[model samples]
Target: MAATNFVRGSVLKCSFPYVDRPSRPGPHPHYCLFVDSFEIRDRIYYAVCYGTSRLDEPLLENHNGAIFSVDSSLIKGSPMSMRVTHFVCSHVAVIPDRWVYRNFQARLDFIRPEGRKGDRLRERMYDQFVLLEPLMEYEALIAVNYVRKTGRPGLPGETTLR
Candidate 1:
């Protein structure tokens, strides 16, 4: 695959392999936020925090200082919309560039708001991935801090492309 550049704060849709259910037929599709990227021995790697809509049950208790929620309104051009989407900062994953290029679906982009200089920014749009409005500067800062404090590095699921 050719070299592709992804910016921080970009939201990506990827096929995330199930960590607990290796017997499952295939990987499950999921939305994740692009946080950081680096190159190791000429191979690129991405660090992302996966987002989930399961606000109740087992995942609910996981929402504490490290989780942040994005409302549907903040997300545009998605085929489907959940009432709210939560990203788990502690559930960080570092995946190979090959896997990311192969299983990639869509990504989020920023849209600048119109009107006066002080006017709030408008919702953003993207081509394939769900178009998500960029998080406010403060929100991004909080997320970064949380991820830095709690993020555990690992490829928690299948690492190779099947």
Candidate 2:
């Protein structure tokens, strides 16, 4: 579509995690958010649109809807909050389970070595699942096959994400 289609009012950047691309068409004029909320798609996607000229931009920010509050976790050890990147469609699409697994697995290097790697896995799985989970049901089945059968267990129904 077009940015004018949805952002009729203003360019409010949410706190969603965005990936940096190498480069793109000069002044492609894309919106980046500082907040995290996938549901915002229903309201904002109309204004955002792109294709191959997509400028290698993050297209969609990777946010897993963190479980803990940044303020609550900021005391002894942990930081404020966590950032989870879900490699799923920004709008909607029929995605395969393997695709979801592959998507996240590609982002493993992106994961920071924090104290709780398990927590990060759950966050990544949840975020990715939120976008692809409802569209398909092979996640659990594929996960099992990837783990027990493959001799490599993953986080719940999530792939190893490696």
Candidate 3:
């Protein structure tokens, strides 16, 4: 699919940067929701909220649904909230075609109200609209398999070395 197809309320997974210390080392691939977009000249960027899966945090599991949230901080010591946390909706990025992975394992449609809070965050995160890569079958398989067996996508710090 074209990057244009990724409209508001789209749920996705990518190598999202840290909220506070975005450049610092941490998780590579994080689940995110598409909030809003803007165009700077001819390029576009999407604002997204990086997700968390800290064991000590509260969680909301919408297994059958396409979207969900957790209660943990994206920043290490931040106070816990009712929504997916410890994390922040602070990414303005253009997902390249090579990095796009189609996750047939999960497909979601989040309209207004259902994802109102998240949409607001996304709008706040970015003001530029840009194109992104389409999903790759192979990458989707890796993610799907992991979610199928583990009930979640693999996070940073988890060894892929077998």
Candidate 4:
């Protein structure tokens, strides 16, 4: 089947589109995908971090290009839900550590609220990361409910959502 516009359970690879901001910006606005999943040893690996290392590469190897924002009002609601989970697999015994993967995972997890650290599928992951930017609609996929409930009414770096 062809990819759906808003896919549920299936992770999407998307990027930030360049917008004309009043101030002069970089040659191009940097882009990052919503998230991705990799399958190894019958288990799936999901990642949302930028790269192997801040030093290795700011961007990862398989990253697909950006997904520009679409107006939510343009489309009516549907029964389905598209989920985004961000987590790093903790090191397990017997296997040597994957330094790059673990490092970025720790960075993303650090953004999680103190009480809710550990595990990806848990609702706590939803709370801490999603509410980080209450008004950031596009990135809101990860924590729409947490934001609707407790978000302080503003987008990241902006004063108020309104």
Candidate 5:
């Protein structure tokens, strides 16, 4: 997908050189939600945060990473068979302008709203993470809805959505 068309809820499989392993010598698959995207001069940038299955882990000392505890109810009716329950919202990443189109995979299934619980989570995630600019409430809601709503039954296609 083109960087110009990236949306808030898209789940992407990106290569992270930051994660290192003693036995592995290559980039690992870092799944993240496309929270925001913008163009600056000649390049386009995306703000993405890490998602994890370890809900027990702390936010840690990283100011760029924040983790949200998700539950089985959120994934039960969804399409992507993800095992994760927590999303690390503090670990915000700026997708390189060049790799936007190359690494994008598909949009996963999402859930609807869970009222105050969802609202509080969104507020907390946004407040803790440093963004290039202020994230609009609507935009945040869109991303949250994408994660909370059980919309479809398969990985979204490569076509640009929203």
Candidate 6:
């Protein structure tokens, strides 16, 4: 999917490279919700907040950031099969368009060499990465508003898109 197709509220299951662990074997695949997108010097960048099943009590209670929880039933056809997922609004990642495209192409290439089976695998991968269910507009608005209001620092420095 083209970066232009990614709008706010889109929930994508993509490989998020581990910034702290550069020596990790491969990209860490997970779900991320697109909260905002903008262009900088002709390059498109997306501001995304990560979704996790683990619930952090302290963070939810006293952290300056916001945490929005979504029941599994709210997410139609959830790939993660999580009973409850929380979006950490305070921790955001500004990802570049090229980073998204590069990882997508890499996944496709890895699955495309196996003939018919490869085709099926590629289709499933595409659905997860590009066509996954999206968060409701209201939910996205609340999350985005919290992030903005709290001025939570997003991922620092340039994200190393592996």
Ranked candidates, highest lDDT first: 1, 6, 5, 3, 2, 4
| Worst 10-residue lDDT window, candidate 2 | 98-107
Instruction: Let me know the TM-score candidate 6 reaches against the reference structure.
Output: 0.51
Off by over 4 Å in 5: 1-3, 17-26, 60-66, 70-81, 97-162
Count of backbone collisions within predicted model 5: 16
Candidate 4 residue pairs that clash? 15-66, 15-67, 153-161, 154-161
Error of 5 at 8 (Å): 2.5
Q: In model 2, what are the clashing residue pairs, if there are any? A: 2-47, 3-47, 14-33, 14-34, 14-35, 15-34, 15-35, 16-35, 70-80
How would you encode candidate 1's per-residue C-alpha lDDT over 47-160 as one tens digit per residue? 666678875544545433445555555554444346667765545555555445343443332332331134233232221123222332323344334334434223443322
Highest TM-score: which candidate?
1
RMSD of 1: 8.8
TM-score of each: 0.55, 0.20, 0.37, 0.21, 0.47, 0.51
- Candidate 2's C-alpha runs over 4 A off are 1-131, 155-162
* Candidate 3 local lDDT, 1-162, one digit each (tens): 225556543555656544343323234665555444433334443344444554232222221111233323221222323345322232233333233344411222223334335665433322211112112122233333333454332222231210
Question: Can you give the lDDT of residue 35 in candidate 1?
Answer: 65
Candidate 4 regions off by >4 Å? Answer: 1-4, 7-11, 15-121, 138-162
Instruction: Show where candidate 1 strays beyond 4 Å.
Output: 1-4, 21-26, 76-83, 101-162
Task: Return the number of clashes found in candidate 2.
Answer: 9
How do the residues 1-162 of candidate 6 rate in per-residue lDDT, one tens digit apiece?
125665444565644335574212126555666666655445555566666777766656643335555554434333455676676654556555544432321112222334225465444543443322243233334433443444432344332321
Candidate order (TM-score): 1, 6, 5, 3, 4, 2
lDDT of each: 0.48, 0.24, 0.35, 0.23, 0.42, 0.47
**Ten contiguous residues minimizing lDDT sum, candidate 5:** 153-162
lDDT, model 3: 0.35
